[model samples]
Target: MQPDQEVPPRVRPGPLRWIAYAMGAGLPERHRTWVLYDTTTRTWVWRHVVRTFVQLAVPIALVLLLVPGAFWIRAMAALGGLILGMAFSLAYMTEAVENRVKKAGYAPGSAQAVRDLAGREREALDSERRRAAAAKRAVRYRDRRNR
Candidate 1:
């Protein structure tokens, strides 16, 4: 390496660093909560849960609201309703968490510690996903052996 050559500048980390790490590690599908630090003492938080069953209830409710003659339209309306419901629910969750963080007397995503915490959360989620996958594979192997 030539000493005179200028080295590329390192990218400064931000509140979204943990999300990038999780996506990079191939654990984006895993459900986890993430905290974000904006420029305040407190960080932002996000969590994914197995809410499919709960979310599905919206579609079912829509189906129940349909009248008898318009079958196709009923089905379409149900699908659209389900989608809209989920979209609004997600938006509400994000806003609520941000408000909570703000009320906690800290600015969201401001501190170095918050950034590190987000990274740690991503790592923990990645590890959990790997463990679950391994367990699933072990069960499948054992079932095959029994067969």
Candidate 2:
């Protein structure tokens, strides 16, 4: 609270603000904007889709240029490229999201922490339900004894 203490400077928002937001970055009021997909997973999936397309297209283009192949050959190469790109993207998605989260100033495994918390909450709710059922049965037995 001392006037002599220097305040930390605010970060200037960048082009990847939406991705950063998905990765748990706090947005400044000035930089907050409308987004079509609200959740981080949705935005990340969309990004992955785009990246997969780009990856597939680039390799296909290179193959067509360098291979001097018949139409069927080029088409097969394109198919292979698509398959490979999809497989790579599937493997890469988790790493990509984690990197984005890190860039957004979150600790690595923050997403996992959230999942673990949710699991604990579910277990607690289940335990409470079981306790409530036991209590109800106990009350029913006591009432029957008094009948």
Candidate 3:
């Protein structure tokens, strides 16, 4: 392929890669392609949620197993673990999202960058509209003067 024609990087999809990404590892160049970034971010977040749930549940389950307890006790333990895990996850959701963004080869402040880009696009569109309107007015004035 020609140098000007850039080829997209190849991303390796697997459990190990997923685990690494969940632990906040940086994304590889192949994974940094814009087309794949969104999907990768979503998958990373989903995996992180599952990992968090499993991480929180295992110890609670083991501890509850060791303790001689009623059915209600075990149930409550599981419920509490779930709630605690969810709370912690919610508390760190922003960080998780930002991590995913960074892993996908974007800056943490890329949301603001996106907003700035959109603002520039809007300004350009508005300028084009104004120019079109002015051109129409100029044409109309010229037509009236000729008649």
Candidate 4:
């Protein structure tokens, strides 16, 4: 081939192409039981962090209202109460992770589709290589016969 010869049209796997497929395969759409639990727990924990403030504040505020003036001490108790409330939340979160692992198995149609696509891609690449090799062989045969 000449130095300036244009490269043949071949599929060169690029990072973007590979990542697009990977992104498609790694969707958060189909949640297994375990995955559902784990994901829910993580989400709930964040929500609870916000809720705990409101939950602890009302009772603490009431007590402070009844008492003369114990704002600082009540604030400390409220912080501690928040920690106590988190125990149950953490337990549920642990359960969710466990459920996810328990129900953790291959996805329904996703795995099969990925496998089929990969197989087709490989077959296409193989065919291209075979065609190129055959062309090279034909050129070599003609050169030898000419000599």
Candidate closest to the true structure, highest TM-score: 3
- Write candidate 1's Cα lDDT for 18-79 as tens digits: 44432222112221122233222223322321233354664567585756657778777777
CA shift of 58, model 3, Å: 3.6
* Model 2, backbone clash pairs (residues 3+ apart or across chains), number: 0
Please tell me which model should have the higher TM-score, number 2 or number 3: 3
Q: Pick the winner on lDDT between candidates 2 and 4.
A: 2
Question: What range of 10 consecutive residues in model 4 has the weakest lDDT sum?
Answer: 20-29
What TM-scores do the predictions have?
0.32, 0.46, 0.48, 0.30
Cα error of candidate 1 at position 146, Å: 53
Find the candidate with the highest lDDT and give its number. 3
Residue 42 displacement in candidate 1 (angstroms): 19
Indicate the residue-level lDDT of 84 in model 3. Answer: 83
Candidate 4 error regions (>4 Å): 1-107
Cα RMSD of all models vs. native, in order, equals 16.8, 8.3, 8.3, 19.1
- Model 3 steric clash pairs: none
lDDT string for model 2 (1-147, tens) is 389987454444666864555444556644322221121432546765665575466577888778886988988888887888788877877676555455545578664455457668889999999999999999999999999
Question: What lDDT is reached at residue 17 by model 1?
Answer: 48
In model 1, how large is the Cα lDDT of residue 146? Answer: 100
Give the per-residue lDDT of model 3 (tens digit) for 1-147: 489998676566466866655455665676665423443443545655776775576667775787677978887887887888788987886566666666676677664455457668889999999999999999999999999
* lDDT values, one for every candidate: 0.50, 0.61, 0.67, 0.51
